[model samples]
Target: MRDVAGSWKDLTDDANFMAGTLTGQVRDIAFVTTAVATGDLSKKVMMDMCGELLKLKDSISFARSDRERPLDVEPVGGGGTDAV
Candidate 1:
């Protein structure tokens, strides 16, 4: 009976730790998304991640880079629309 109780406590602790970790990750993602929506691309998810979360982080980074790239483009003749 004592061993059973100990096992249950261990399980509970593990669950709590996982919950906290996931919650933090979710909040981080939310903050980054919000910043992006507000036209603030300076924020990036700096957390170390894996699995699906890693993919999400990569996607956000890709989007930020895509947005940043256009700012670097310059027209050929002191700023005039390109003639097709």
Candidate 2:
């Protein structure tokens, strides 16, 4: 028989690499969004990503500089900050 165990290990390693990359992208995006939410408008999605995510990254980057971006509205009839 062939060395099937080695092939299996290789496949597992590939899968692990892919999964790690995907999860890392997610974590990076999350961090960037949180930073933006805290008024860090300079944050952008700079992680490696796939097709749709490439578009999303571009969108996020655009929003970072888009002057038309919606401002943070205060809560209506509730406790909230008055800062504009």
Largest lDDT belongs to which candidate?
Answer: 1
lDDT of 2 by residue, 1-84 (tens): 334578787888788899898888888788877887788887678787879777777777776778447789867656665645
Best by TM-score: 1
TM-score of 1: 0.75
Q: Each candidate's TM vs. the true structure?
A: 0.75, 0.66
On residues 1-84, what C-alpha lDDT tens digit does candidate 1 reach at each position?
234557797888788888898888888889999999999999999887889998998999899889988566667866886665
Distance from true location, Cα of 18 in model 1, Å: 0.6
Error of 2 at 3 (Å): 12
Mark the 10 consecutive residues where model 2 has the least summed lDDT: 75-84
Regions more than 4 Å wrong, model 1: 1-5, 71-84
